[model samples]
Target: MQSTATSIKAYLEEIPEERKIAFTKLRETILENIPKGFVEQMSYGMIGYVVPHSIYPDGYHCEPKLPLPFMGIASQKNFIALYHMGIYANPELLNWFVTEYPKHSTQKLDMGKSCIRFKKMNQIPFELIAALVQKMSVQEWIICYESAFKK
Candidate 1:
């Protein structure tokens, strides 16, 4: 669900108590492993990791005033979601994550394009997410995003 909270801290406080721990850990995992040059902020009503305008001043094509969004994490109505633009743009990365998912969690991969939904919070695979987060650097993401989405 989209949140009205303007900051990550406020967003965290708004989510259900049952999700606070896992969601916090998930956010921490991303913060600790996400490559440098990415900035954290509230984006599209979620906690987003983005390539700032200082680096890519063109901003997102869909929303030129905002930063280039690379990834986001949110506590949805029924699931927690991780949205990674790199995997959606790169077929190889998507294949790699799909293949490695079974090794990390027993739950069937519940995914849609870029959004990986974790219905069973206990089964969230932080390690695999860490590895995935590191797979794409800021420059690489810019290139990939331009090649695939920017006209």
Candidate 2:
């Protein structure tokens, strides 16, 4: 479910108390591991990491006023969702994740293109997710994003 929260603080306050711990931890992980030039805010009703307009002047294609989305964390009806634009846009990145995920996590990987679903906090592969987030800088991600459209 997309939250109606206007800010990250509001978003957290809206999440169920029990889910807060896991979500907060994931948020911290993303912040600690996210590449330079990314900003965190409430976007798409989740905690979003984005390439700011200063970094990517055109902003997001779908919504030019907004920053280019890189990753997001959302609380859904049944699970927490992690969205990775890099993984969805780059086959090599996706393949790397699919292969490396098992090495770090014995839990089943539940994903759909860019979205990883976790029914429980323990199911999340924190280190693997961190590596994935750290893999691309904003400039590299922009190139990848544009290249995908050219294909």
Candidate 3:
């Protein structure tokens, strides 16, 4: 998720009316399942979930000025996107998701390396998304990220 919304509220407000409901529902699902110590804020011009600098002093490796980004949700021109860094870093998790997404719905899964793009509201798998989010903790994500830094 990347864009110029100064705040999450601003980010939400900028979403087109057609996307707000889906984004809002996904936002609620994310908020409900996010691990402790992760905070929601505007990042890269979108609504991002991050480990704050206060929790992890080093911040983002590529941009230490920013927090450690875990996930993000953005409404693109063609679809709504969910960026899951945890899945991107963990191949097993990605494989599991790719295998299981179809079980949640019949719609085709459209995804990028770390982005799950929903072309329709019904294409969003709320329970599956919630389950995926719940699988990672802040500590787990930090450890995974740190290990990546070593290589």
lDDT of each candidate versus the true structure: 0.96, 0.89, 0.89
TM-score of 1: 0.99
Worst 10 residues of 3 by lDDT: 1-10
Candidate order by lDDT, highest to lowest? 1, 3, 2
Each prediction's RMSD over C-alphas, in Å, is 0.5, 1.3, 1.3
Model 2 residue runs over 4 Å out of place are none
By lDDT, is 1 or 2 better?
1
Q: Which ten residues in a row have the lowest lDDT in candidate 2?
A: 142-151
In candidate 3, stretches whose alpha carbon ends up further than 4 angstroms from where it belongs are none
- Preferred candidate (lDDT higher): 1 or 3: 1
Error of 2 at 122 (Å): 1.7
- Sliding window of 10 residues with minimal summed lDDT for model 1: 7-16
Model 1: per-residue Cα lDDT at residue 111: 96
Ranking by TM-score: 1, 2, 3
